[model samples]
Target: MMNACPEKVIRMMDDYLDGEISPSEEKELKDYLQSCSDCRKIYQELTKTIAFVQSVSHVQAPPDFVQKTMAGLPKESQRVGVKRFMRHHPLMIAAALFVLLMSAAMMSSFSDDQQFSFTKQENLVVEGQTVVVPEGQTVIGDLTIRNGDLRVDGELEGDVTIVNGQYMASSGVINGEIEEIDQVFEWLWYTIKGTFQDAMSFFGGDDQSIEE
Candidate 1:
């Protein structure tokens, strides 16, 4: 039998076998192992056991495993149904919420005594708080104004549409038809349809004119 080593040397030997010791600690453990036959034997047994465990634990997945497992599952149509349901549920809820909020806002505005005024200043078309047309004494394109009253004191070469508000033309020349939309629902529908048309025109490379 080999001579017994100290408990401290055995602990250091275990640390060295596990590669958990610093270089200096490893050197100390190596020196001790060379002098202590019992510790060296323990280290040799630990190393062999670890090597055997690693060799047996290395595993590779079979090539046909995924294919075979998927073959037993349900069709993609069933999964797509669930996915579409999940996707559209949120969109439907969001759409409903948006409609509700818009309705509330429109109702509140309708009840209020708020009045909007539009004016032509130099080359700028001032509508309420926003300035839309800049420095064009004469508008050459179709002018569509929504959610406010419109007053034109200049010349327009194209059609004019006023939604959810009144239209007043004073000394202004309109070369095309003037449309007035006062119903809230009609205005909302027209706005939404116009937006969709604009998006389609942008993506489809079409030169369709949409109401602004």
Candidate 2:
């Protein structure tokens, strides 16, 4: 908002939302909001957010909620036990996590075996790191090329998935999705997300929007 609402008007808007603004102040705020789209947008957003919260029925915790929670928690003397344990034995925890991460990464890398790994060799030509679908050749079934790039100068009847690689789509007819995935880190991230989402779906939870 290059030209912002006056500070007094902003305070008036807040007061108006809270039902504490004087009649004159409320009029001033409305007049300013009508003229300034920037302030009006902000005010509209504030109204939506506030209205959502305000419109909800007042909910009270169960009678035993506080008691149950307090009973489950440790006594004050030992409340900081976990923190103290972590502080004193950081090395052990760190070592275990480091080993686990390394083992998982190693297993993933070994399983990948990206040395010219692919699915379906028919109708495709491999030239070093470049996989090519020559002109006039039509390949059937999905083609997954790992640790390599693909040049599609011909027709592909199914999906073309490139792992840790790139592709050049020229004058070719691709009948399905052409997916390009980068190396280990990205693959690992997607694997974890997929697993988590699967678990959530299984439990009837909505898919979470988790981003890199």
Best by lDDT: 2
lDDT of model 2, residue 142? 91
Candidate 1 pairs with clashing backbones: 123-135
Give the per-residue lDDT of model 2 (tens digit) for 96-159. Answer: 6555655675577657755767776678887888888889999888998888888888888898
lDDT of 1 by residue, 10-65 (tens): 77776777778788888888888788777778888889998898889667789999
lDDT of 2 at 32: 88
Measured by TM-score, the strongest candidate is 2
How much lDDT does candidate 1 score? 0.64
Clashing pairs in 2: none
TM-scores for the candidates: 0.35, 0.40
Overall lDDT per candidate, in order of appearance? 0.64, 0.75
Query: Alpha-carbon error at 38 in model 1, in Å?
Result: 66
Alpha-carbon runs more than 4 Å astray in model 1: 1-68, 71-122, 127-136, 195-212
Model 2 gets an lDDT of 0.75
On the 0 to 100 scale, the lDDT of residue 162 in model 2 is: 86
Regions more than 4 Å wrong, model 2: 1-106, 110-114, 193-212
